[model samples]
Target: MSLAHLVPAAVALVLSAAPAMAQEAPRWSFAIHGGAGVIERESLTAEQDAAYRAALKQALDAGSAVLASGGAALDAVQAAIQVMEDDPLFNAGRGAVFTAAGRNELDAAVMNGTDLTAGAVAGLTTTRHPIAAARAVMERSPHVMLIGQGADSFAASVGLEQVDPSFFFTERRWQGLERALRQQNLPIPERPAGAPGPQAANDLPAPPLNERKFGTVGAVALDAQGRLAAGTSTGGMTAKRWGRVGDVPVIGAGTYASNRDGCAVSATGDGEYYIRASVARDICSRIHAGASGQIAGQAEVDDALSLGGSGGVIVMDLQGQPAFAMTTSGMYRGAVSSSEPARVAIYGDEVLRP
Candidate 1:
């Protein structure tokens, strides 16, 4: 062959190789939440509410950047949760709710989809951020779930920062607990004090009237290496009984990820129902079994609500598709993808509306 012909052929081969290499390299995508639900209009002033949503956006942007820069999915998930914890708006880290006993206890979990490896902490009182502790459990501990004092010790051993227990207390959350307790003590009038038919009863404790929803925090991300990961953090249920554990620290119930399948994070309402439903992993399995991510996720949410439960989720499938669905009137959700910016909402309808 002539020298010029050989040169052109070599150049063409090199150009073809470049696209192949690009295709093989890792790409990233991610979505996150402070929590999903209906926030009462009264609880958040326009300005305070805007600040909360903005914090969520900042976290999403930070995590997305990490994933885009070739960071691991685990890193993205934890980073996002950390921001939520710091914000004191959503019930995860620093702003976690007070227990029935008037103490703040936090829980968190993280999982790597590539291996179905998971780690979690429950009833942690001193860890500054439970998500970081959860990751440390995954990376350093021989066990998958740790609790209470032991979880704190493990976090310290692994170089995670510890703060005073008071560091987690928020005046509003403490007052909320007081309100819930006061409602529990109200007496019902037997005859409605004037007029009534059968006479209604105030048997159950007053329902939580907080503007913010069950503000658990979580993230799912596809890393530059194409691995999937998910993490969840929570203050647990408002006015939760002492030692009461919810879905937040449980693997499949609250948070689940399988790189071989997909990644999911669930904010379980009626934790009992979510535990029964195994909501998080079920959604991912449906997607893995050939359902569209949106279809599978929405179906699961509907199923949960149909059973008289309510909550929502944010997820990223193995194909890097993102989906959000809620069983309640709304789910506070946001995402950063090829689609749009990471915005926040008190109502899912507002966020999802066209």
Candidate 2:
């Protein structure tokens, strides 16, 4: 064949390959929150700020590794949350706040969007990783939620890690508990016997009220296979009493995902108000009803704000896009996607990319 004829044939061949190349690209994406509330620059020292950012980055890396390998969205979300849950920097597991009874009662939920199956555990005091316990509930039990002693029992039955409640102790959280109870004119309960005794003065006596008002850790992810999953873990409110439960263990409240809706949402903040607004489910619902994820996130959070809720939500769509909305001054949040680098920001004025 002549050189001109060969060139035309090659051009057509390259054009045909373009579609296949595009299809081969991974569509994975992920986002996480270490909680959302009135965080101020003045509240954290330079060192403390760096530590928080590092912790968030670690969580992003954990999830990103899973998604990059074409893992299930549920696994990616769980992996990200487990990192934060083990870190004392976040308010979920190790650093969980104390209750009025001087105990750490955790709550968590996991949702598989592909089938809409979900599992949750509330007021669980011994599970080392509540997110894992939540997943166990979904996979091993017929129920959607298990709580308190029952949840703890179920978790152990499923071979989930069980720890002494003291494993959750952190001086900062203890200080926060003392301050919260003092503000309420309540007596301080004795710390658990097995927990380590207080040592240094490195802890904040009482963080700002806004910061104390809310704390949680959560994640939402879209996997390479286009599945969506979400999970949220929380220490609940400081000084909560009489077996209190929050939105974290409530599917469609603090965490919701739906493949049919093409979205997954995870929320952090004032659980009471979030439950009322149905923030997580509401955001995905609006998207299913034709609203964009960004629009849905902000609008639903606005509704929660109207009712005096202060918190934030992270939303991820099937296309590997993420959206965030918060009524509070700041949220410890971050995102990673095929098209975006891992980035985190604490303040609302910060660029949305991180």
Best by TM-score: 2
Candidate 1: where are CA atoms >4 Å away? 1-26, 40-44, 186-213, 338-340, 352-354
Worst 10 residues of 1 by lDDT: 1-10
lDDT per residue for candidate 2 within 22-63, as digits (tens), equals: 554338888888888767788777777778888899999999
Model 2: lDDT of residue 263: 91
Model 1: per-residue Cα lDDT over 1-354, one tens digit each? 111222232223223222233343225667776665544565456775567667777888889778767788898888888988876667877778777676778999999988888999999988998999998888897889999999999999888899877677665665566666677773222221222232332112222344223778888888767788889898887667749888877888888988666655555455666777888888888888987566676677667556664677777876566666665544455666433345455554353211
lDDT of 1 at 147: 100
lDDT at 307, model 1: 65
Error of 2 at 74 (Å): 0.4
Regions of model 2 farther than 4 Å from truth: 1-26, 200-209, 352-354
lDDT of 2 at 230: 96
